[model samples]
Target: MSCLEIMPKLGLTMTEGMLAKWHKSEGEKIEKGEILFEVETDKLTNEIEAKESGVVRKILVEEGETVKCLAPVAVIAGENEDISGLLKEAGVNGQEVAETKTEEKKSDNTAVEAGPKKVVVIGGGPGGYIAAIRAAQLGNKVTLIEKEELGGTCLNVGCIPTKTLLHSAELFSEIKDSRNLGIDVGEVSINWKNVQRRRKRVIKKLVSGVKGLLSYNKVNVINGFARMETENSLTVSKEGGKSEKIDFDSAIISTGSVPFAPLIPGIGLEGVIDSTGALELESLPETIVIIGGGVIGIEFASLFSSLGKKVTILEMLPFILPPIDRQISSMIADKLSKQGVSINTGCRVTSIEKGENGLKVDFTKGNDNLNVEAEKVLVAIGRRSNTEGLELEKIGVKTEKGRVCVDDYMRTNAGSIYAIGDCTGKIMLAHVASEQGVVAAENISGKNVKMDYKTVPSCVYTKPEIASTGLTEEQVKEKGIDYKVGIFPMGANGKAMISKEPDGIIKIIADKKTEEILGVHIMAPRATDLIGEAALALRLEATVDEVVTTIHAHPTINEAFKEAALAVQKRALNSVN
Candidate 1:
């Protein structure tokens, strides 16, 4: 079916409007309700969305052109439809002009072209997979190369598996408290094998879904390790001596990261394992010693301790989760202590040795020797960029501190090559990698973009999940910025009582003069999900009053945000100021 576009009438007296901007260009395919164009009326600019799905065959009135109300402005028709008669009826000679403009759009890369160039992406992590899909959408022939599996570390061994196990642990923890929730019956036990099986299934399903997404985007996938032969050339050597060479117009590297294992005596012992080895545990250990106090360390501590293990964490820093707010970290530490998890901060591990029955870890706390024996030891110190085989040096790609160097545009020193995700070492989170991938792809496809980290949220999957975005109180103090903080406890939240999770609080920091929300930190149930609102408020430069005035859902954890906002001005409703 063919549909003719017309200048929409805004008010009864309105007679004309100026075509402001076209969201979809001529020959662009559009779906129903997609913003097709904007019109400037006497009152305001209004976006006109497509009423039906079709291809934009002709743009009768060019942008900035004035057209009378109810007059034809464009023509939409089914795919490959002849719109010559419609153009003739509208008294418009736009076919030739539209064709020429479309020819220009094809070269620009913002629009789809008939002859798509090649885009070879190394690594099939979140960043690489997303970039592959994006480039494919931009009418580029995208080929994604991976050595082991799609979804990279995040899906195979990192984020997905960790979170899945965390959820299982959380459930078991809840079951252990079933009596308090008005449940009389229960003998709860940690079925570690079943939990591992479920986590594996979830990961397998997601990896398969990622494959489907790549397939849907028409991206070709190669199962092999890829190495840069030159700036524009790559060689992939598959198993059984199979190898192939690929050339590309532009390339992206998102090889992700590997667990950083430092040089320590007996670090390579059978019982000493990194984060990946922790996930592949054959059976639950009765006693465990975790060798770091960062995000990875705390998370594993939470997991094993919840599942009935005597988990001990050793940190060389003054506080666990050093990147988090000091107050929040202390509160979480206290909570973990109450849960039987021993946290040793400012403690440095000197060496690991074979104990009489198990592994022994020797450490120091302010020059005093300390030792802990455990059935298993996990080294969750940190992660480093995994560039073992890509041969970034082959193409003269610059790197800094063991990570590929890239500009704000995510482009490497080589103009045709770009790097994002863990390979660039920017924060090393999967979500961050995904966004950086989009930025890199957009820039390659003729879009002006830059990666921003100001409002990025960090989440830790502890018992009471910790999440924060924007500035921290310490940062404000260091900068000497006058700021005020508001805090609301979960003890007062009705949902918290119903859910039996009234063990945390929400804190909001804002500028004193401007009242703009500068940061939000939460240590509560579902804090990971609740932090999105705070991130958005900070991203939009919204004031505490704006968030306070916005009505939050009744009897929910998110209401803590509103009350916290109100408390910033000493006007909290549910809590006494």
Candidate 2:
């Protein structure tokens, strides 16, 4: 029998590895432990050596092709051994194929079998896709059912597409502001059609990538709407009147959430839309009124304002980003206002009416009723969990306030069933959902794993990105935990000064008794990347003293993190005392 060399899993988090380069080709003699291919994982890149002393009769995967772990990458056989049949069976060739057929056999066997545990995951959004991939990795048969697109709201209509447009908007704003650095250029203009086209292209690429990943992991992708049939089964209905009954030992409901539209007269007027509809960008309106001053609203406000549209934000709360530190939020609000964005806080949209030329919005500020006019109205209140279609009661899954309830292990009341992501009603972040998905999978695989929300980070992709991990100052004060605050402004950083884009701050909270870092918050350019150190610091229980002692690279933004720790003890190097 020929020996099949499969791509070995390098790490727990690594699902697929790229064949960076092929050292040996097909029909070549290879010795045992000889380097055959170099693979690149998320953490690192390494070479895979041959296990058997024989001729490399087939190379299943080629350079640049990212194959899943444990999937066949090559086959070795003796010189006289007949390997043509094996090669043909495995679809081996010199050129790399986008996807391999090995996973299909595995998925078919697992899905059709009754002995192995089966899992039907609803919705192919960020949460759903992650859960399906994790379930498949844990040796369970997974059928991921999606109604519209694989990535659901986040990838299809929400986060991914919106971010792409925001990137364009940001670029446009930057080009216009290039004169600040004495770099004068021609007049900057934006072709809205081209911007929309680029956004669509990005969305298409990401959606295809997600589909490929699911296929590589042996996760069966079903394009349909899924509703609960019973506690242990779900019925997926396709578009062409065809339906399949999926029997599952357990089910992970990751249907995610959708934008919640408020009830008001003329709210559904021609020019009025929700966040998802606004992302279409059919045409940029001259003026826009964005209701709700939350993350979604502010994000849209930033994008539209940057695009040279007159944008007004109506916020019912006293401040935007109410969950964040008031001091930090006020700074961001001031920055937005300086950019010509109007923010009206402590105001609620009572009603909207369509005028002859534009839309009229009637809002109330306490006892005063105010009227505003805009070309388009956008409702950005919040999202509601997608728990409507799936009859949870029939399946014995308990839900509260339109959200599925799961324990620390991500398991629902229905013993074998699990719930994750937005449906679980925990932290609604994509990374948090992905982590929960893995925890659910591990639990199903007989491994004792639990979801850790304490270390989960939150990020807002605004002008100066905001990222935070761990407890907030309010929580610390409320709990009466003796904590020391350390803060460092970006203006003092050498890199920030050189870039001429320094308008942010980094704050660290540490336990006064133990000196252990309890939380870290940052607002700066590429603050998302800088938060990793803080996250690791909190995860490893690194104390403020340790962080301060660690030598950071000079003239870098990361030095701010180290300096902030030094500021905790009133020993900052750059701070003017």
Q: Which candidate comes out best when scored by lDDT?
A: 1
| Candidate 1 off by > 4 Å | 1-115
* Candidate models: Cα lDDT each: 0.87, 0.81
1-577 in candidate 1: lDDT tens per residue? 7888788898887877767679999889988889999987534889998877899988887654455677778889998888778878776534443454465556633332223568899999999999998778656789999998899999999999999999999888888888887887658888889999999999999999999999998999999999999988999999999999999988999899999988889999989998888998979999999999999999999999889889999998989998888889999999999999999989889999999869999999997999999999999989999888788888899998789998877988898899999989888899999989887776676544578898899999997899999898999999999999999998999988788888888999999999999889999989999999998898778999899889999989999999999999999999988
lDDT of 2 by residue, 420-526 (tens): 88887787777887888877765665444567677777777788878888888887999999999888998888888777768988889889989899989888877
User: How accurate locally is residue 521 in candidate 2, as Cα lDDT from 0 to 100?
Assistant: 87
Worst 10 residues of 1 by lDDT: 107-116
Model 1 C-alpha RMSD vs. true structure (Å) is 6.2
Best by TM-score: 1
TM-score of 2: 0.81
- Residue pairs in steric clash, candidate 1? none
